[model samples]
Target: MVAVKITTVSTRLRRSMRAHDDYAVRVGRRRLLVTVTAHPGVARRWVHTTLWRHARRLRSVDGITVGMGVQWTPPFRAMKYGAEPRPCTLQLCVGHRCLVFQLAHAGAVPAVLRRFLADARAAFVAYGVRSDCRKLEEHHGLKVARGVELRRLTGMGNASMERMQCRS
Candidate 1:
């Protein structure tokens, strides 16, 4: 059976407690956020397919949006505890001079996480990002989509105190 993988990318809107999460590509000042989740084997396959399909289109320096919805679990749980859905959603934000991409597919092995990363890496370079693909690939487990921005994050880049505090 085909397996499914889920991933996300986002950016920080403001350095405030109430900053909103921007999951689209747009001209703005914020940090780039990305997340990839899948069983190791399946993730490899999906990532490969995704990167091969969209690499060429991302050869620009302008921000673009890409979103993919796959079976997944929310980062956290809320009131009911463990009430999050199994088939979760994944989103990301490349930035003003960035591009966003989403992939929703099913599979057992060779998930789509790799493809998503590869495309993102190409896009990042198109936007003038001087990053190392190998390092990013190793660190993130998935292939390097664009820039190695994730390598720059020290803590939870996507997790916001306000959002976390909000009703999950």
Candidate 2:
């Protein structure tokens, strides 16, 4: 992945806010909101691939370097657990140190998925980012970051401003 410096400054301001998907990535000072299909695996793949494929072009508009490659880390069990836990892992090295999000199923993985993960990981390493998310976090916390969890939200379509919501 490549990096770019943000330069465009918006002068016109509007009070209206448009709805957007929860997942997004930030490189340099620019933010991108992209839509991916709901499947975690497919979403993960698209995130990395899309960034890499469009990095150069994107840089022209935003003055950043986006690289085409993925670095996927091996799945590890969570630190605490009574029973089995869902696999939470990372994909990296797409577009200047970007990491793709994903969820892995239990037991052995299929060969194709394994290969994709490995390829992504290798590409990530090739781009020189520390593929481990925890290491990255420990080193740099809450800097140019975005995340989403299955939290409860009350809303009708885009009518979220006045809704009350609860989650467990």
Q: What is candidate 2's lDDT per residue for 1-168, written digit by digit as tens?
A: 324334453322222223213344454466654332224445545555654676575456333322322223443655454333332434433343243333332232233433343332223222223333333334322111222111121223333322312210
Q: List the candidates' TM-scores in order.
A: 0.25, 0.29
RMSD values for the candidates in order, in angstroms, are 15.4, 16.5
Clashes of each: 43, 10
Model 2 score (lDDT): 0.35
Question: Once superposed on the true structure, which residue ranges of model 1 sit more than 4 Å away at CA?
Answer: 1-38, 68-168
lDDT of 2 at 9: 37
Task: Estimate the lDDT of model 1.
Answer: 0.37
> By TM-score, how accurate is candidate 1?
0.25
Q: What would the per-residue lDDT of candidate 1 be over residues 47-150, giving only the tens digit for each residue?
A: 45444555565565643344322224354645365343333323333332222222223233234545554554344331112323443333334454545333
The candidate maximizing lDDT is: 1
